[model samples]
Target: IVQTYVENTRLIWYRHFCNCTLINGKFIFGYYRLIPSYGLELIVEILLNTRLISISSTRSNTIRKRLHICQPFINKHHFEYREIIDIKTNESIYQLNLVVVSSNKDTTLIRLIENFEREVLKYPNRHQCFTLTILYFYQKNQTINQIYDLIHQLSIKYTSIIRLSIINQNQINYNRGLGRQLASKLFSNKQLLFFLDVDLIFTGQALDNIRQLMIHQLSISSCTVYFPIIFSYFSSMFNVNNRTVIDINSNIGSFSIYGYGNVVVRKQDLDKTGGWEINNHEWGNEDVNLFQRFSESSSECNVFRTVEPGLKHYYHKKMCNGIVNRERQKICYDADGVLLGSQRNMIIIPYGMSSISTIDCSSFEPYDKPISTWKTLVTNLNAAERDYVKSYLGQSLVEQCEEIEGEIDSLLDIWRDYRNETVANCTNPTIHSLAEPPVLRQRLTTEIEFFVKHI
Candidate 1:
């Protein structure tokens, strides 16, 4: 039957067979005489009906010359396989809902959103599953129309990936934790919720890292919460004119983990813990309070502190001025800095670990004393007394206070020097001092460099 079919079709398909060679008991066609472009397809079709187990191209000049013609089809199929893999990978990625709270009309908000979108777009697979919920906590001074316009523009620009939600409220009573809880409630479809401050900008690699962490957590169970260590620092104060510039070489202590900054928790886990506490509207210790609540939640819940650097905080004066007041609220935290409440402790399950551990907040001394008394104790402590103070306050809390004190002192020194130079240049003017203005400016620049490099 095969012999008859080949003989009968030989007349019509003779040109296709003209360049044929029998290798390893299978017919290999070199080129099609009439339709060269359709040659590979025809060969593949013919082989599908035959007893051939495999296909190969010849290395001879005749076959190699026309082999280049089939390059497009080969590349096309290659991309098709890649597209399939990408789609599968994307489907596996769990949904990440980023909740951002913006109250004031800080111009930096736009930059923060842009940088976030840019970072999310870097991972196409992850971006497809990511959603951004922006909760605009309304203030009286902020222009309502301007806020609407900004929201509209962002909605249109990120129509495909981002799910934007803008909520308006009349009072200035919205805190970070409350705003995040509201945003999470607004978007119920998301599996994971990441609370992000409006002033913080995350890198693309950092986003990818968080995505992987979320995926790992999801694989274990849907009720898992992860917190990435936020790298927070004031933008170089001396170089106020240069926005978006951060000192990369600064110590890790400069980037303390603020409770409100880069926090990742499962929506289900949040629900289990009754979401973030909304009572603290003044933005003081809401994040810390919420963290303590999570720690004291049910034992099945998994909470972890990721040691990776995933988020960076931009410099803002409001944050700098509010630090002292915020730190004062930390006295409510246990000696280990965990919020005080609940005899029932929450379990912390590290990534890739089957065993679970509880946060022991019992060893630290009680924060019954006022902030002034605590400051007095810290100030009067000698080397031995300092170690004793650390034992009561916990080493982490003491180190953080010391770091903040150093930073404040450095900032005050820089401000004084800059002010003195400006006043001197303005008050005492001479022909030689005309050149002194430029010299003073140069000195200011040098001082900024020295501060960033040495500090």
Candidate 2:
């Protein structure tokens, strides 16, 4: 009986199932109907001869106004217009999968989720094909029932357009990078993955801008990643009169080149870069590490930065108590061997390093020193002591310490010569500008060559 039912269903599908295609400005439709012996009936229908309208051909504002005006008509007679509209023609264009990592901060998480929902509803077109996945770390501070109730309420509220999925981490950790890495694996089917911090407050206009940028990047076959030039407004920048509004205009030019507050990239690009560094936890250079890996993956992969204004970041207190301030200046170059930026005044401490107590003291703070000094200290420490430090400092810090030490030693001679030349030319420099001089290109090239050979 089961074989007979399967054969009948296959025959029906073979006869009637067809992909809707546009030919000569008209769509070809498919329709199917099946009746079984058990009084089960099924029907599939597709609107015929639909006119394909390219979203790019018309301004979004005009389309929005038209949609608003025809909303009532659309509801009254949905069938008449169903066959004439195709907002998105490319079936595999892009689908945005938003990943949010949350923890015991229930109130803040709730507020952020609510704000996102409100913004999404205001600009429905921006999130037309979007899904929200929340990775909640189970914290002892909040009861499990409370979390379930909050998730249930949210699911009911945004049931129309947004598909919401909640993932609960059985064990809680301070490492946000690890949580994001795990959450990313859940959305393997989605083309674009957007990682957003829960503290960020996004406006409707900003979301629309992001949507347009992602769509444009996806449309370009060569462009594999899209990074937005994020403008940050600290907690102090919030309007005193209205806490909800942020004054982002005041700090217009002070934008970070590699802002990770909200990162949007194709899943393939992320996969190529091995995704976020799972070993990173608390506050570290996880974003910078991922960016570097992405650049190294492919020269053909284009990274475009959107400078449009729409998103604002809110500052919060640090979760860890570490005072290891590493102030060494390192010239970091991009994938094209161009000087992108310099790393300086970095606070390098392992996640949860300060939380553990030593046997001799109630608390311990790792002494901040140069990479070379740290390497010497590590070498001099006993086996048991080194193991203890390793356990507390985590793998990321241990590897970084070793790498920095090697890099510094390898580049010491070249750096000394370059410095001497720079000092001699300082008195009678040809260029007085703040920008890097063309004469220094040789020095930078040498540094890059050294890195390629050793790194």
Off by over 4 Å in 1: 1-93, 122-126, 144-147, 238-247, 251-253, 258-260, 318-455
Structural similarity to truth (TM-score) of each candidate: 0.49, 0.47
Steric overlap count per candidate: 1, 0
Q: Candidate 1's residue-wise lDDT over 200-294, tens digit each?
A: 77777776567667777666665566666665553231221233434442321234544445678766677777777777654356677666665
**TM-score for predicted model 1 compared with the true structure:** 0.49
Candidate 2 residue lDDT tens string, 194-303? 78878666777776566556776556554456566665543231122223345544322235455654678776667766778877543556776765554442334555
Query: Which structure among the candidates has the greatest TM-score?
Result: 1
Name the weakest run of 10 consecutive residues (lDDT summed) in model 2: 62-71
The local distance difference test score of each candidate is: 0.50, 0.50
